[model samples]
Target chain A: MVKVTYVAHDGTRTELEGDPGDSVMSLAIANGLDGIVGECGGSMMCATCHCYVDDDWQAATGARMDGEEDMLESAVCEVTGRSRLSCQITLSEALDGLVVHLPEEQV
Target chain B: MSAGRVVIIGAGQGGLQAAMSLRQEGHSGPITLIGGEPGLPYQRPALSKAFLKTGEADKLALRPESFFATKDITLRTGEWVDAIDREAGVVRVGAEALPFDHLILATGTRNLRPAIPGIDRALDLRTLDDAAALRAALDRPRKVAVIGGGFIGLEFAAVAAGLGHEVSVAEAAPRLMARAVSPEMSRRFRELHEALGTALHLANGVTEVTETGLTLADGTEIAGDLVLLAAGVRPNTELAEAAGLEIANGIAVDAELRTRDPRIFALGDCAAFPEPGSGRRIRLESVQAATDHARAIARTIGTGTATPYAAVPWFWSDQSNLKLQIAGLADPTDDSVTLEDGAVLRFRDGRLTAVETINNAKIHMKARRLLAAAPVPTRDSLLQRNYDLTAA
Candidate 1:
């Protein structure tokens, strides 16, 4: 199991565990975390599951996918350099303690 | 304002979201969500796409069973609402009459069964159970005949073809998905489906569902062992009509999605509200519309603010490695210009109406943002910008 911590915009932290193959967005959604919406069901079509990777965990989380930046244009929040769609980030054993921060709102 | 009992009919995506949104807006009122289908609320989009291929029923649930208990919501499944008592503010469900301070009608839609002979022989793909039965039928190698070349039929054809089934699609229209997508998109998808080895029969209507397969209106017969009815759906408005609520194409509602009776509201696929800019009555059957409408209605009930439903409409369909996305709505006469990047911009009366893209998420997203602005980008504006959505 990989451990991932989701920090809300107001600095609330939620740590959860998930299998290696599961995506971070799916984990947050299954746990009922209000941050990520994943409206398109991890199809990378809807950017509602946008998140900011913690600076410390940025290297471990790697880079965005091919169409990730394009989908982020539809996000309701500001798109920063640290921005990443959580649905594209697949969980793996290499980076277990992945800490990510959620945006103010996802609609 | 008193936190009175809020009763929502229909447990589909919109109905479930209404209950959840009311709680999110801090409405402490008692909430009851009634659904005609059994089990928890599940999404219908994947029923024709991934669910048919993976048969993963567990992943379709919108929320867990514990969600109702934790959120203090009364979820009554496998139940049908008999009638609405607007005078007494109660709904008849079997022998019981559930009262409500405010009533929401989210009664979605049902499949349209044409008067063709032996139509009952063809199966439907509306609910989860229908998808399950269709999946079970695909367990063996068989010739699959799909009626209607719309989103559902084409999506199912792509999957069945991938599964090594002999797939053939019959569409009554001249092109595929004529009502939803632009002509350019229809042509592109026709090529895509053909490349996937699926046979396409355009401008042909099924006159009869014969024992062997389907007989076209031209008297040509297509042989198949399994038949699917993906024609279309009709809004379920009988209950609202009998209750004396105004009914147009659907239940007539205002910008706030409320019926003539102040205490009654209708939404989702069953409500025909005015369009944001055009003020034309229209009804959409997409997840984006349903969920957005639910949020708008919940805010009106929760915070006492009747904000108009103004979310930009968007839709998507997956077929054989192609992801088609549309950012806005378009009429039948809308002119389409295909950009160099293969994105189609729909224009009506010089203003941009919709954007259709295949696997081009950036352009689609940018089009959505541009369409929602105060002054939409005009056709000449896009042409001057070299059809660049980011700048427009």
Candidate 2:
């Protein structure tokens, strides 16, 4: 398990522990971290799980795949280099203490 | 009232999502999610596919039991809400009358049972329980006749055919999924199903249902070991209508999903609201619409997402080798332009309205993003870009 911080639109931080294989989206939802909606259940079909990975956790998460990069474009706010779908990122030691920003809209 | 205690009726996708979204949007008020179905609320999409194939009922749950405690949300499943007293804003489930400050109706939809003989012979695929029963029925050797060539019927036919069972689909429409897909897409799907060894009977509406078989409009009786009904759905508007709420095709709602009574709101397939990007009104049966609707209601009741909840609509269906993804809503009147990438962009007048893609996720996502922007791409420019809609 890994502890991660989810920062909402209003700048509130929710720190929670997530299982290794579970996604950032699933854990946020399982923990009720607020603002993270994994509507498609990690099918990568719906981009409701969109989130922003901070600079500190970007490299560990690696570059977005073609499928995710394309979906991220449709995400709520302007897609930055840091934007990523939380569903694609699973919890791992590499992401311990990782922090991601929830977009203003991800329903 | 102080938004005192928010009471949500119906624990399907929309109901569960209503409570979850409300809390997510920062509403700390007393939130309750009540579902008529037993056990945890699960997704209905898999009823005809994965669950029908493997019978893995456990995986389909929308959330774990601990989620309620963690989020401080209350879920009352297997309990039915008998009445909604709009003026007093109290819901009755049998003897208990639960009061509410704001009542949300996410009751969703149910299978439409057509008036046909021997209707009881056919099985359904709407709820988790229904899928479980169908899975057991598929165990024995049986020839299946599916009524209604919509997505659910076609999906089940494909799976049953793939399982070495002889399957036949009888649809009243001239083509498969006529109500949901374009003619081109429908034709393509027809060819795919036929190639999979499933017999297709277009425009063959079931006139009469017999114990051993179903008689079509053309007077042809197709014999089957078992019959399945996938005749589509009708909104569960009894609670709303009984409560004196304005009812159209569904419970009529404004831009905010609020019912005629401002204290109550509705969403999902049961709530027919004005279509964003277009003035037309429509109801959608998909996970995206339900969750999006839930979030919108939550924002209004929780934090303030005061902008008229104009989120773009999207949908998807999985059948055998094809995975159809649609972004936005379009009707038959919309002029459709097919892009070079096998993606079709639909438009009403000159405005882009929806995008249809098969097995092409990239184009689908791009189309959604493009439409999200104001002054969406037009048919001319979209064609110029070879339908590379991302050119925006």
Candidate 3:
């Protein structure tokens, strides 16, 4: 199990063990992390699963897939140098302790 | 003799909701819900996702078998509505005729089976049974060819590809979901599908749909074991047309969702109600629209005078982890601004046409309320609050 840390919009942080091969969004949703609606379920069709991958983990996380990158265009929070959709990022053994910053809303 | 009965044709999402609303609004008249498909009414949105995984048909039912009995709502499944006798105010189902005080056509839309060769081999995802059939086909490993890069096609493609099936989407349009989304959004989904190992072909038209493969307009045959038709949908307006009610792209209805005949009201995918925003009649196939239309129709039946159906249009699509949400309707001509946070807001001239959001439910919901509110939001109010449209 990979250690996943989610930083809430209000600065509260929660950490959970994310199953390998499962997406960060699914993990967040599974753990009942607020602000992540995951309305489209896990489909990239909606961008409600936005999260900024913590800077420390950006180097570990590779480039965003075209679908994931394109979907980030509609996210609410600034997808600055570290923005990424949690649904698009699947956890692996390589991503042991990944940190993702939660966005303000996931409609 | 007594109050007239309201017979709703096509017991889909909209039809079922209309029946419930009619009953909820305290309409004492008889309610008969008829459906062409067998089994209880079920939600179609999950037909592409959860149902595909579980293959549990029982869970898909919108209302249990006992729902009809408890609600005093007559449900006739496995029977096709043959015609609508406007004069008699009744719908003919084979040898039987169900009379109605008011006819509500909720026949919804059907998948457009394109004119192609080998069409018999392809499967559909419109109905619950169709999704079950496709789920069965998924048990084995094979290449799936999806026709029409619309929502269903792309959605199924995402699921199939995620499940490790090789998938391909052939779209005749220049971009995927071109009619529904902005160019930027289209490009995003296209890229996402590509990265997921699903092959996408745009600007390519299909001339023939074969069981083993598909023949493109350019005479290119794409090999496949199964061809799924996600080719969009056309409103089921044949019954209304035969009845001599006005038929535009869909069954034409005035502001009150009443067809030419004042006694007939329509909603959901079948009826083309005057667009709340554009005022140029449009038909939508979303749960929100169907539910809202049912509520609006209920208000009329309950009180007296009916108000126009004016509900903010919002949509959501799940594609392999990316949840795309749209708070408003944006046309091709609408101008789009990419905010600092990457949220794409569409504007028609000066007014906000729509808000395209991915993973940002706060903005999406806020935008919906803002658009639906009495006072339209200006650019400053939206931009001032750090691009938060919900900010007053």
lDDT against the true structure, per candidate, is: 0.91, 0.83, 0.80
Best by lDDT: 1
lDDT, residue B186, candidate 3: 88
The runs of at least 3 residues in candidate 2 whose Cα sits more than 4 Å from the true structure, single-residue gaps closed, are: A1-36, A50-66, A75-107, B1-3, B304-307
Q: Return the top candidate by DockQ.
A: 1
* Candidate 2 iRMSD in angstroms: 2.5
The candidate 1 chain B region of ten consecutive residues with least summed lDDT is: B58-67
Candidate closer to the true structure by DockQ (higher is better), 1 or 2: 1
The structural similarity of chain B in model 2 to the true chain B, as TM-score, is: 0.96
In candidate 2, what are the lDDT values of residues B92-206, reduced to their tens digit?
9899889998889998898899998888888888888788888898898788999999989988998898888889889998898887767777887899999998988898899
Q: Give the TM-score of candidate 3.
A: 0.77
Candidate 1 regions off by >4 Å? none
What TM-score would each prediction reach against the true structure?
Answer: 0.96, 0.87, 0.77
Q: DockQ for candidate 3, please give it.
A: 0.05
Better of 1 and 3 by DockQ: 1
Candidate 1: DockQ?
Answer: 0.55
Q: What DockQ does every candidate get?
A: 0.55, 0.36, 0.05
For model 2 chain A, give the 10-residue run with minimal summed lDDT: A29-38
